[model samples]
Target: MDNIGKRIKHIRKINNMIQTEFAGLIGIGQGTLSEIEQGKLKPSIDTLYELSKHFQIDLNWLVMGAFECMNLKEYEYELLRKTRELDLDCQNEVAEFIEFK
Candidate 1:
């Protein structure tokens, strides 16, 4: 999706959640969620962060479509966490290995 609203809506739909249910999960009102999905209102940073944390969404993709919507498995999430602990050079090496493989 090109816009944050669309992306949010896509996430909800893909997860089989209605506005009320999804809004409740993210601590938002159904009306506010509707407004956001309609692009009539922008989501606050707190809302974005909640969405990212709750859904394991990639903020980059949610904000700018910079990456795929990454719903990582548990092991994948652990791998990412471990990779992030590495120094920049080691991170680059890991990335290169992944890319090459």
Candidate 2:
């Protein structure tokens, strides 16, 4: 685990993609990919952006090796979790009981 390279390798392996396949998907040759993974070459910002685009991940996560991939607020998470717990059987009754009357 050598920081960026390690994270890249970790993510790649987690996704079940070989270095060659990941490299090809990201538009880099296997040799260049090897160099990057070995820390022989730091990826340029543009390259990082391209990699982010390729993986649909934030460039900051790729560059800084940030552990969090999502930024869900605690309240948002709780609200969503609570919303899912509402019984569907009572949904229509609940909806019809508006307080306006």
The best candidate by TM-score is: 1
- The Cα error of candidate 1 at residue 77, in Å, is 14
lDDT of each: 0.83, 0.65
Q: What TM-score does prediction 2 earn?
A: 0.58
The ten-residue window of minimal lDDT in model 2 covers 74-83
lDDT of 1 by residue, 1-101 (tens): 56889989987986799999999999999999999999999999999999988877778868876554455553564477458668899999999999999
Tens-digit per-residue lDDT, 72-93, candidate 2: 5535433443445477866545
Residue 31 error, candidate 1, Å: 0.5
lDDT of model number 1: 0.83
Candidate 1: the clashing residue pairs are none
Give candidate 1 misplaced runs (Cα > 4 Å). Answer: 68-101
Compared to the true structure, candidate 1 yields what TM-score?
0.66
- Candidate 2 clashing pairs, residues 3+ apart or interchain: none
